[model samples]
Target: MKAAVHSRYGPPAVVRVAEVDQPSVGDKDLLVRVHATTVNRTDCAYRAARPFFVRALTGLARPRRAVLGTEYAGVVEAVGGGVTSFSVGDRVFGYNEGAFGTHAEYLAVPHDGPVATMPAGMTFEEAAPGTEGAHYAMAFIRVARVRAGQEVLVYGATGAIGSAAVQFLKHHGATVTAVCGTAQLELVKGLGADRVVDHTAQDFTRDERRYDAVFDAVGMSTFGRCRRLLRRASSGR
Candidate 1:
């Protein structure tokens, strides 16, 4: 099998495709023939080893796992004894954080992990990115406990996480206000935000209206600055 292996990573140049031994299937795992995968901020952060915190999950000296990817779409080549949810040739797509080998042609993942059978209507590429945005957006909305009819602000509303957060907040019944550059104001509004703020032209905090929650999707704002624009309680980053 060929894979983008990283023994010690510093940049994308460090990663190279090479022939490696096939991974053995485990008792509670499924061996998947990867059809598609998505490169995301997590992969870049892993490669760069930035912010220091992410290294804890990989390794201190080097990466614990050679391949760096979380979202994958593939077909089950074989299933372990304890697995009954999927069979050989079943199309599936989901996340794998512990065994991050989605960049390769094949990967072994625990059946009971974040992996899920791909929805019938979705394509491999479409399903792959779902894990990251959906998972984080859902978690953020829950943590903030967004209420119906309340004003919710999503900063950096054009990015990966911000795009998902905009919809999630709207789905939760909050009157969403998305903050973005002038070019993305319409795009964010199209994502179901009730109002859009062009951050280039206006400072969001300077606005008199206080929001129930202000999600700084890009981690640009601190807690203190967001507090001035929030209604007593809010969450960011």
Candidate 2:
């Protein structure tokens, strides 16, 4: 199997495509012939050992795992014994998460680990990148306890997580306001944001209206900066 491997962490240049031994299938695992995978911020963060603390998991001086991709869409070529959830020829998409070994021609994933049949009408390329954004957005939505008719604001609303947040909030019937660069105002609106703020031309914090929740999807803003935007409880206290 050929995979993108990085023996040491530094920059994008450290990664190279090389042939490596394919993963062995465990009794609960499925051997997949990878059709598509996505290189996302998590991959870059691990590769660069950014924030410095990530080295605790990746490695102090080098990466623990040679292969770096986290998300993949592939077809099952062989299923290990006891694995009945998927079989040969099944199309699946999922993330490896902490294990992190999907950037290859073949990958072995446990049948029960985040793996799911690809939705109808979605291609491998389209489904692979969707998981990263969807996962983060779902986490924030769940933690915030977002509900229908609530007002929500998403900052940096054009990137992967931001765009997904806009759509997810809108789908749940929340009135979503998105902040992005001028070039992406219409793009964010198309994702179902009720209002779009151009971060370049305007300061969203100056707006008088408050929201049930304020999500800085890109980590570009802090809770202190957005506290004024969050709705306050009534009773004039």
Candidate 3:
């Protein structure tokens, strides 16, 4: 099996395509022939071991294994003894955070781990980034407890995560206001944001109105600044 092997942590140059032994299927596992994968911020962070805290999972001295990838869209080539959910030749897309090696021709994961049947009318590459975006956006919205008729603001509304956040918040019934640059205002509005604030042109905090939740999707907004944008009863860290 050909894979992107990483012997060291640095840049994309450090990742080499090499022939490695194909992984064996364990009980309750599915052996997948990876068709596509996404290179997200987490992949880059793990590859560079940025922020040092990420090294705690990869390794302090070096990476545990060279292959770096997470979200995968692929077809199952084989299945293990206890696997009933999927069989050979089923199309699927999902995330594998710990066992991050989906950038190869073949990879194996437990049948129950984030893996799910691909949605109707979706392609592998299209589903690849969708899974990752959905996961993070769902996580934040869950934590925030956004509700219908409540006003919520998502900063950085045009980013990969931001775009997803806008839709997720709307899906959860929140009246979402998206913050982005002027160039991305239309894109944010199309994603279901009720209002689009051009961060370059206007400061959202200066508005007299407050919101139930203020999500700094880009981490570009300061704690004090965002806090001021929140209503007194809904302020949260």
Candidate 4:
């Protein structure tokens, strides 16, 4: 199999697609023929060994895993003996963290890992990049304690995290206010946002309405800027 590999951490040019040995499938593994994958910030951080401290986990000297992808969407070419939840030819997509190795022609994912069957009618390309964004969105939403009927604002609503956040927030019964560039207003609205704000023409922070929570999925808003938008704590207690 061929993979985008980097022996030493550096720029994008350091990674080169090269022939590498295929992963051996253990009893609980699914050998997938990868059809699509995503390159996100996590991949870039690992590839460049950014923040310096990631080396403590990835490697002090060099990356322990040469393949740099963290997510994959593919069809199962084979399944290990112990695997039952999935079978050969099943379409699946999954996410991994430290155990990154999806940027390749083929990948072996654990049967009980973060993997799941692709949603009905969804293409591999759409499902490939959805895992991480949905995972992170769920984490952040839980931390925010979003609830039904509460007003919430999501900045950068066009990107992965923000887009998923909008849908997740809506599913939680929160009234979502999605902020994005002019081009993505309709798309964000289609994601179930109750209202869409084009950040280019207007200032969302200056809106008279307050929210139960404000999610800055793209790191474009500081807490200080969004503080005024959040509803104040009840004083009765």
Best-to-worst lDDT order: 2, 4, 3, 1
Q: Which stretches of candidate 2 lie over 4 Å from their true place?
A: 233-237
RMSD of each: 1.9, 2.6, 1.4, 2.6
Whole-model lDDT per candidate: 0.85, 0.89, 0.86, 0.88
Writing each residue's lDDT as its tens digit, candidate 4 over 7-90 gives: 999999999999999998999999999999988999999888898998988899899999988888999999999998999999
| Colliding pairs, model 3 | 6-66
> Cα deviation of 175 in candidate 2 (Å)?
1.4
Q: Give candidate 3 regions above 4 Å deviation.
A: none
Each prediction's TM-score against the native?
Answer: 0.91, 0.93, 0.95, 0.92
Ranking according to TM-score, highest score first: 3, 2, 4, 1
In candidate 1, stretches whose alpha carbon ends up further than 4 angstroms from where it belongs are 233-237
Error of 3 at 110 (Å): 1.4
Predicted candidate 3 versus true structure: per-residue lDDT over 38-115, tens digit per residue: 888988888998888988999998999678788989899999999888989899988988888888999999998999
Summed over model 1, clashes come to 0
Could you give candidate 1's per-residue lDDT for residues 57-76 as a string of tens digits? 78998988888788999899
Cα error, residue 165 of model 4, in Å, equals: 0.5
Q: Where does the lowest 10-residue lDDT sum fall in candidate 2?
A: 228-237
Q: Which segments of model 4 are wrong by more than 4 Å?
A: 234-237
Error of 4 at 99 (Å): 0.8
The C-alpha local distance difference test score for the whole of candidate 2 amounts to 0.89
